[model samples]
Target chain A: MSDFIEKFSSISLNDIKNVPESDFPELTAEEKALASQAVTYSNRIEDADSISNLNDSLRNKTFIVGNKPSKADLLVFEKVFKVASKWSSVEDVSKHRHIIRWVDLIQNTLVNVPESEKLKVSLDIEVPREIKE
Target chain B: MVVTLTVAAKAPLVPYGSLIATEFVNRSNGDGKIDLQVVDQKSVDSADANSASKLTTSDGKEIKGEADVLKELGKLFPDVLQEVSKSQDLIDTAQNNLSIKNFKELATHLEKLDAHLNFRSFMLFHKCTVADIAVWGVLRANALMGSIIKNEVYVNVSRWYNFLAADERFDAAIQNFTKSLAELKKSEKLSKGKKESHKA
Candidate 1:
């Protein structure tokens, strides 16, 4: 079970690195097409600048929804932190007040396991390089 | 306003929550749209499980239990379930609760369940409806667990996962989530190996 959860955690992280236009690998035909469509859809709803701003604003709080913490934050936090750390562009955008507050909330309140233990579990796993393009 | 289903941190429903939201939204036909909101349920203090249980939908609808949702979705979207069952290896790799020998049996049952989904004249609606999204979430979580175990048998499942990952909307929301998980583990490993080297 721990193995499964650990692996799940790793896969989630890998997915963050696979996003379009993050200096990650170029998208395959399908990914590119899908990404283009999403960009269009997102654009139709709101501009990139606004979306970026929204993300920045949302980052600082300890909770993403409701008066208390929820699972959605756990799933999203791991990825947001990774993206913010790995990509300079993402980091720049994530440095907004909301994002910082949210991250701080997660860091201070949400984290249940010891940081060292988490780091240890993460270190034990091996990441495969050959993710399908 | 769009109706969204946000998950709490450490909630068991996190894996399948978005898929369920997608299914609900797809089926709502824009009537009562279901937007997926992934919350950090883990932030809720451990002692607050009872309080967490009381959390409701944006409109105050209580989220259904996992089993109930799965059964309902299974009845609604049989075809998607069939597609998911086709990736047997992926199913086998998700968790150790099930034995390896049960893979074939599970696959067989999944096929039957798929058939049930496809049974058009059986009074249920046709096509991939919101119910399919529910089942899809379960299958997807199982496959995710399998992939992490490095189960080689799940190659076909991997193929299917890649196909889903290629989609922009799905990717936009889920890609970051999965990738961060993978990296967190990797960074831990690198740091640990370094520590061991110093100790040596």
Candidate 2:
């Protein structure tokens, strides 16, 4: 099982879609690697420890990879966005505030899609975890 | 003319959106001429406009996609299609709301549709065009639409929906779909639909 999991993870990393030049002109290597990483997020998001790593990675960042939206953002968006609406409550959502933020941003900024197509995250209800004195 | 629409040979035939567009055209027209053939889903997608166009008057005019099938059905009834096509956005909006599982958002969307129906008897035109058939058909298919309209939240949408449902053909279309659908074990037909009784 361990061997299978290891091999599976590596295989998923190579599942990244090449962002067409028309979508976002020549992506630097950093963006390309980030896009590849998006493919393995399904695993990362499930592991409690790895999920925190994702949350921390997204703290100050907007997109998952490069500052400009690219295939990486969309790949992660594909994994996370679908389940975001069913997070149960604000507690589950507020725990991943940064992830939620990135998901919402990708939906709106990544593509000039229609309003109905966009996934909405009501950030207002997610109150501060603790008001720092 | 024997109108035939092709969809993939998938199970638990969820008839909404473009998937059921041909059925909508066939049943609403009461012509019973349309034949929904189950072929390889790949062949339907590979059928380009070049080939599909040439198939205009025959036993096998390949429909590129369900939406293309919709446009073909539209061509058969120009005036009805024109009006109903305008209100297709309502179908899309309601579908989105349902997807997110946001009842609040759905009510707001329904309010807008309700407002539209407030002034006019139908969606875009004076008569029940494909617009009424399409919108009403989808909402009836949804499980939650029952309670949402139970108290009649949006009187206009409820009124319009029931008004359209009163047509026996609309009811029959649903009955036919449900009876056929019952044969297949429910796959991930509609995640939203899974929680409720699949009877609808």
- B1-200 per-residue lDDT for model 1 (tens digits): 44444344345434452444344345433444445544445422256452212223455545444433333333333433323333333322322222223466555444333233221111122122233333344555553345532442332233233333333444444554455446655665787886664674
Q: Please tell me how candidate 1 rates in CAPRI terms.
A: incorrect
The segments of candidate 2 whose C-alpha lies over 4 angstroms from its true place after superposition are A1-133, B6-13, B17-32, B37-61, B64-68, B79-100, B184-200
How does residue B61 of candidate 1 score in lDDT?
Answer: 49
Q: Which CAPRI tier for candidate 2? A: incorrect
Candidate 2 per-residue lDDT over residues A10-93, each given as its tens digit: 112234455443444356787677656655765566677656667666643445653344556656666666566666576776
Per-candidate Cα lDDT values, in order, are 0.37, 0.51
Task: Give the winner by TM-score.
Answer: 2
Give residue A62's lDDT in candidate 1 (0 to 100).
19
